[model samples]
Target: MGKFNRQLVNEIKKEKEQESAQLKLREKYEVPEDVMIVEKDNMIKFSVRIIATLIKITIGIIIFLLTVVGIVSLVFPETRNELIFQLSNTLMQLKKFLNI
Candidate 1:
């Protein structure tokens, strides 16, 4: 065959190869035209879980502190009055510092 004929044949073969590759890719990863795929919103789910966990931890800490205070007040009734007086004085000092 002539040089021009050989070049044309090669070009046609290359185009056909490219077309077949495209078809294979389309077949492998085909999405239906009418169907819609909704992806899972993992970020929202993760945020909700994190917030819930933090709330649970905070509640647990508050409960623990309250239990400790109750035990201490029960064990040391006399000291409780002193503790309250000190806390009130500390709060006053803090208020003065903040000028609030």
Candidate 2:
């Protein structure tokens, strides 16, 4: 065969390989015939899972910070007194607001 013919054959082979790869990827991602697919429900479920994960992470961080603060307060009498005073002030403010 001529050089041009050989080059054409190689190009066709490369194109075929690329097409097969794309087809495999499509097949892998395609939903099965027996399965039901609802995009709206799937989106909502994914969002709810993400929000729940974030809420769990935030709660974990808050608990860790509270634990550290409690330990520090136990080791420092001044901090414990300040914490108590600040808590009382906050409660009093809330009490006034609730009375209104």
Worst 10 residues of 1 by lDDT: 31-40
Model 1: pairs clashing at backbone N, Cα or C within 3 Å: none
TM-score top scorer? 2
lDDT of each: 0.81, 0.82
lDDT of 2 at 17: 82
Model 2: which residue pairs collide? none
Task: Give residue 83's lDDT in candidate 1 (0 to 100).
Answer: 80
lDDT of 2 by residue, 1-100 (tens): 5456888899999989866666665567795544433334588889999999999999999999999989998789999899899999999999999994
lDDT by residue (1-100, candidate 1, tens digit) is 5457888899999989866666665666685444433435698898998999999999999999999987897689797887888889999999999999
| Model 2 TM | 0.45
Q: What is the lDDT of residue 93 in candidate 1?
A: 100
The root-mean-square deviation over C-alpha atoms between each candidate and the true structure, in angstroms, is 20.3, 12.8
